[model samples]
Target: MLADGLSLAKMNCFSRKLRRTAPELGSSKNELVPSKLPRINGWSWPLHGFQVVGWLVYIYLAIVSFGIYIPLLPPPWNHVVHALMGIIFILHFIAHIAALTIDPAEAGVRAKQSYSSPVPLFDRSKQSHVIQDLHCYLCNIRVGPKVKHCAACNKCVDGFDHHCKWLNTCVGGRNYWCFFVALTSATLGVLLLAIVILFIFIQHYLDPNCLRTAPQYAGIQGNTTWLVFLPLAPVKTSSAGLLIVAFGTLMLSITCLMMFAHLMAFHFYLFYKGISTYDHIKMRRSKESNIEAGKPPDVKTNNKAPKFLQT
Candidate 1:
């Protein structure tokens, strides 16, 4: 009877130990599996600051262009100019939204993984490269030849372009078209605004009466210059107000135009070469590294002609 009782006690003790260790083992397993997807959006202070500054500049330019400059123009030209600007603005805004929101993650990562089933943890100790045999160690999946891991986004992007700090997103296969559209529209809009402002500046000096031909200015005297804040409220002022605003708009527009134009040109060059921004950057870096190593630059391979040219 004592033996039976002692055996029962030992069994109960063993069961208790098993229960404790089972929970520990389960917890460890859970720790190994990631519970959430890697962050794809760039949520940083610089992104927020860029967004704020961009909006402020856009608003200021819009208000001045639509409220003051456009009104100063005569007749049908004013209406036509307003419609054109509105279209360009809409295109730019829509393209920006699309580019910013689209998921540029690699096909396998997007299709196979989610918050509930996150990518498996990569064991770098056993591997030399993050990518081997077209399989990504970090993403733990097979990726395309052009797939690249964006450190900022913490995911692999298919046809990986460059991460745009302004948009706060990765530009890849999915969003590259939208990004290009946004770039093009923004460039056009700023260039148009600059040209209109320049025209207004010339009219302000040479033919001031031509600018005051709007219905609102019909009763106002020629010498009584006015600064129109809103359509309904035209504040009487000297030439200084109009000139100051015109000069400021011109300066901003010129600066933005220069930047956008350069970016557009660079992208066009990449497109003509049938390569992405990432590829161009990588090739350039390889050339520099070779130069540093005192090796002859492999121009034929590094800067190969496009397929069309080769054909």
Candidate 2:
């Protein structure tokens, strides 16, 4: 009888232990659920690699055109090459600005905050749809649809893409067009300069005297004249001049071709989709459409969206 009593006591103890542990197991399962989705990390790898390479190539070309080659060229053509290089350089600057301005799509929130109270910290419910109307308690700001706080910029930008390290700024809605245009112009300018340089090289190679002549200076107090245009009239057969032209031309041609190809591809994709680099990265797939017919609908508020957002 004692053994029977002891067995009953052990069973009861086992049941109590299971009951006590059940809540803990349930809590652990809940912890696995993520509060929000991850945002865009940065530029796509291919675009990043391409931009780095292009920048390096353009910088190298700029050095050669402005610092080394142009100063040594003869009158007329020297001035022409210098003018071309200046254009290319200016375009590069524009490209830098464009890269700095963050696109709307690339921008994203670092963290999200939720409040249960009907009173919003910032009145956004009247401006946005229920899903998009959000109040960030940390910032004490109201964010609209597709709006995100950028930690890098320390502010919210609509449709923000990732912060561009190259530009040292965020690429967003306001500056994306300029950035793209700058890139296009820079690429084109580089190509033109490359062609001109290559032509000079080939002409010199065929006729060494084509690039050689009296080195003319164009400065007031010093020998600091803008490199004049290359004297295109004389077609000499100087071996040394031909060699210099050949090497310079080859380098410029290669760099221009590569830049052209890359920009062409970038623009083609941008135009095909009618979206900016920022937008392509952040917009999510339609999750609402995936909901089953019988599932309870998401609670929506009759909120007025921000002016920047699509209706």
Candidate 3:
């Protein structure tokens, strides 16, 4: 009886050990083995923060592209601007779709360093493994050759550049050309129209009817004329000039911000050991107590030479 009890106890211990080590698989192809894998749930809030900021840009783009239409402009220019605006909207929609379709967790792209394996390698035999390997852990989505994931869109995007929330689309390889075309056309069109309006305002400014008015310079100098009124001339102050300046400023600011972000991100990714912004932030937090107590990072304790490198 004692021997029998001993065997049963050993079996129970082995079963518990198996339960502790076994990696759980999910039902769907896209579902991840949550128990064994790392996760980026903390990143969702920051991503949503960026999305909220993007919505503001979208509203501005929408108002300028669709709501404000001028009848005085030539048919060709008007049609061109309208067409570009429509394209921007479509691109934005596609970006959102891409984000939803590509799940970062399933793709093996976790925001937190602890959630992902240090190497992020796979055998390439399993479909899920293949997908995750293609994605790489640094970013969130699996894309094809020559394609990269857009952080802003939170998905694996094709030929990806930065996401333009204003257009609501991922600037991927497939649509980069279109995005540039729309941007260039819209900028030129706004400048041209602003110039025309300034010219018209100048012409009216010089009219003799201005001098005979009861409030001398009343119509010419009213709040609308001075503050909001736009002249319709290329050379002088008009609605056209105002619009061109405003749009030009907007374009410049957004472009500069995007460029700065890209440069910073690229610099870190290339120079560092494939570490990301998320990793840096977490590392900092993890070491905060140690740093305050005058200790070094945990890495220092485990700084051993690899066998291959030693050889």
Encode model 2's per-residue lDDT on 27-96: one tens digit a residue.
3211112123222323423246545775776677665566545644556877886787787678667666
- Candidate number with greatest lDDT: 1
Q: Top TM-score: which candidate number?
A: 1
- Indicate whether candidate 1 or candidate 3 has the larger lDDT: 1
> What's the lDDT for all of these models?
0.75, 0.50, 0.43
* Tens digits of lDDT, candidate 3, 195-225: 4344334544465243123232344543232
User: Which should have the higher lDDT, number 1 or number 2?
Assistant: 1
Quote the positional error of residue 208 for candidate 2 in Å.
1.5
> Going through the candidates in order, what is the number of backbone clashes in each?
0, 43, 27
- What's the C-alpha lDDT at position 227 in model 3? 25
The global Cα lDDT (0 to 1) of model 1 is 0.75
How much is 59 displaced in model 1, in angstroms?
Answer: 2.4
Which pairs clash (backbone N, Cα, C closer than 3 Å) in model 1? none
Error of 1 at 134 (Å): 1.5
Model 2 stretches with alpha carbons more than 4 Å out: 1-59, 71-75, 94-140, 146-155, 161-165, 216-260, 281-311
